[model samples]
Target: MLRSSNPLEPTTASFGATDIPRKPNYDFERREREKTKAAESAKKAQAKAEKRAAEKGASDADQSGGS
Candidate 1:
């Protein structure tokens, strides 16, 4: 019973089916959780690597300075 004059606007006949909204897949939540977990793991690995490298650089500098 919509009174819109434009054809582009949704009318009463289609019942909003023509809008074509995306429906999420059944595994979407699981997939998203896995993706988040992977991202967090990668971030932690990168941080650990950076910390190790900084420690190694500091130790090397100290050894070279003492000589």
Candidate 2:
């Protein structure tokens, strides 16, 4: 019974296949959770890289100072 000028829009014709209202398939909650997780992961990786670089720089400085 959905009314729309666009014939492409969903109607009772496909009602048997879906139970939920027809709309874009986007899970905002899931996307937000994923985005948060990704940001945390990126932060952890950056912290690790910085720590490694700092260790390397310290080692280089120590070696130069000894010689």
Candidate 3:
């Protein structure tokens, strides 16, 4: 059996070199979530405004046609 000559050298696992996991960036993740929420809210608000405008126009047409 071949063995490492230097005891101080790092030993490798049978699979390969061990990998250290990266730490999560909570601040960046929070900012991204906030941005997505804001965009969705804006979209919903725009749709609601368009629906209100359409209803108002239809009501005006009905009143003029009935007169």
Best by lDDT: 1
Q: Model 2 TM-score?
A: 0.59
Q: Rate the local accuracy (lDDT) of all candidates.
A: 0.90, 0.88, 0.89
| Model 2 lowest lDDT segment of ten | 11-20
Model 3, span 3-66: residue lDDT tens:
5789866555464645788899999999999999999999999999999999999999999999
Query: What tens-digit string does per-residue lDDT give for candidate 1 at 1-67?
Result: 5788898876777674665778978698889999999999999999999999999999999999999
Question: Any runs in candidate 3 off by more than 4 Å, and if so which?
Answer: 1-19
Query: In terms of lDDT, which candidate is stronger, 1 or 3?
Result: 1
**All candidates in order of lDDT, best leading:** 1, 3, 2
Please provide, for model 2 over 1-67, each residue's C-alpha lDDT reduced to its tens digit, 9 standing for 90 to 100: 5688988877666655856776665798789889999999999999999999999999999999999
- Whole-model lDDT for model 3 versus the true structure? 0.89
